[model samples]
Target: MTYISRAAKILSSRVSADVVILGPTVIGEGTIVEPMVVIGHPVRAKLMKALGSDLGIDEYMDSISSGSQIGSNCIIRSGTVIYEDVVLGDNVETGHNVLIREGTRIGSGTRVGSGVIIDGETIIGSNVSIQSMVYIPRGTVIEDGVFLGPNVVITNDKYPPSRRLDGVRIRRGAVIGANSTLIAGIEIGENAVVAAGSVVTKDVPPNKVVMGVPARPVYDVDVFIRKRAEYEGSKAP
Candidate 1:
């Protein structure tokens, strides 16, 4: 009972009833799309140019990509809105009510939790886990094995209505705790840990742990991991 657009190419995918797929999209094998999912929805380029041109926010004009591609073994939950020009690798899972904008590239084994809003032009690598209510702005780059806890807000714009907006870069294996806010143009280095409720305004070095407002270096990441392991072991029955 799937309603696929005549222009779309589905390759042995599973789409639930009430799902709409428009434009030129390609779905790979073993992909499961739940009900109320919108794929390859059309965007009004004229509207963007009309309103954004006056504000110097013309960067969103090229946000739409050429085609939409979902790889094998991907699970797109209900109420998910995925725009055109996005590519997803195998074994990706999305929770309900997720909004994924255009020009996003997601690698294999990525799990996105419910109510997550990922803006356009985002590049996410393999084995990343983004928890619920996380807001990832456009132009963000998340490397492999990054873990983002719930309510983590990653901003892209340095100033409102400015054309010089840039997103944050999160390196491989970094862990961002819940309710952390990351400002634009900052880099979280590999294996770094940002503690909960931290407001990160500057770059974080590799293998370090940062906490507090305008988060500063607290300790080594390796030490924190070791301590966590010890605590978990102590709690074992």
Candidate 2:
């Protein structure tokens, strides 16, 4: 049998309570602060400490790393490490132990899954669904409504042993499967679907589906659009 830990239970004890001290911290009022979680933000933490006697903030830097920006109405589940200069929009939800690096702009309603590593200077659009353990390298721009499967690796260097080149751009609504690796400088078109474990090395056309290593077309529109339309019409209400 597994035992679950409650956040409220840890904060109840004076000796057991782990205090955090920060500058410019701006957490919302009536927010539940769990025990043993150290957060740093100088001015805001000091302001909140003066107001509430229930608050205890004196060891933030000793426990958690600094310079992370957490927005309002966000649910950062336990064990998450948000890196510096990462701008998370409102209503973003992150699972445990997620890593969002510096200069990353994740749009509103984006759900960064557990254990995912989003590298620096990347732009993730609104409503994007990234699964666990995905590695989005530097300078990649993932457009809105994209679905990334678990363990997908998006590389930025077209040439191996590269000298800090820019990353690839995945257009809107593209679905990349688990364990897939996308090569740099290629533009994946909108609404395209790449199958699991594929290696992307070229440009993918819009509204198409590809599979296998070096990802070739398997489900082009010419092969199934007419049949699909007939099926849709037959089932119309």
Say which candidate scores most in TM-score: 1
lDDT tens digits by residue: candidate 2, 1-237: 111122112211221133342333333322333333333322334345444444333333322224444455666665554444466666677776776665788887889888898767799998999999999988899999998999999988877786867588889988888999999888888988888999989999998888887799988744455655888889557
Q: Residue 183 deviation, candidate 1, in Å? A: 0.5
C-alpha RMSD (angstroms) for model 1: 5.6
TM, every model: 0.89, 0.70
Please report the TM-score between candidate 2 and the true structure.
0.70
- For residues 29-110, write the lDDT of model 1, one tens digit per residue: 8899999988875455743454635432222222332448888989999989888888889999999999999889999999
> How good is model 1 by TM-score?
0.89
lDDT of 1: 0.87
Shift of residue 98 alpha carbon in model 2, Å? 0.8
